[model samples]
Target: MSAKKEEQTAAPAFNLEKAMMDYSGDKYELIVMASILAAQKGKNEEFRFQPRDKVIKASLAEYLAGKITREQLVETYMSERKLMEEKQAQEEKRLEQKAAAPRLELKLSGESL
Candidate 1:
């Protein structure tokens, strides 16, 4: 039982120095992305699953390491944004349709529908 608790409480290992070494040039871009994403996560509950800073750092490191191309990042973000927007639009349309549907309220005082 004690061993299970210890394993569950273990902290994840992080190597910041290695990550920095992996990413080169235009650190400002990474900073901006991280800040923007962090703010978005704070306001949007759906985005809180992954920490913004970690996402930004890992993305930059992967880019520098050539694990993923910059174009891939751009494409991924654009596609995700597009999908989210589309979903929102569909939801709005559904709500509008529901609202526009006629609702019948029968009065109790011998009123006709």
Candidate 2:
């Protein structure tokens, strides 16, 4: 086989520019979404199978495959961040209330003596 053909075969079919154009949203948004996806996927055990591929490429592939969208990714990330913030605030409030709660102390009673 020719070296040129071998090189073509070795290269992935994915075209980054073409994939970005295929995305319905703006290219910039697609890039942002890929970044967010990579971060999210990095933390996920299910996505750990593709350790050889860069997270960003895997993320972009996911977008190209139509498995997810920029809006969905952004919304989900924002909602999760908000929920985490709320949970942290609640924990802080709980700790504050516990600290503020009056502690009862036992006093010696003359009657008992």
* lDDT leader: 2
lDDT of 2 by residue, 1-113 (tens): 99999988895776766777666767787777888888889888877666735878889888887889767898989998999999999999999999999987666874432
lDDT of 1 by residue, 1-113 (tens): 69989888888555666766666667776555544444444455555576766655654444545665556556656787899999999999999999999998888899776
lDDT of 1 at 31: 58
- What is the alpha-carbon lDDT of model 2 when measured against the actual structure? 0.82
**Model 1 regions lying over 4 Å from their true place:** 1-24, 32-57, 109-113
Model 1 Cα shift for residue 5 (angstroms): 36
What is the C-alpha local distance difference test score of each model?
Answer: 0.64, 0.82
TM-score of each prediction: 0.55, 0.60
For residue 77, model 1's alpha carbon misses the true position, in angstroms, by 0.5
In model 1, residue pairs whose N, Cα or C atoms come closer than 3 Å (at least 3 residues apart or on different chains), thus clashing, are: none
Query: Residue 71 error for model 2, in Å?
Result: 2.9
Per TM-score, the best of the predicted structures is 2
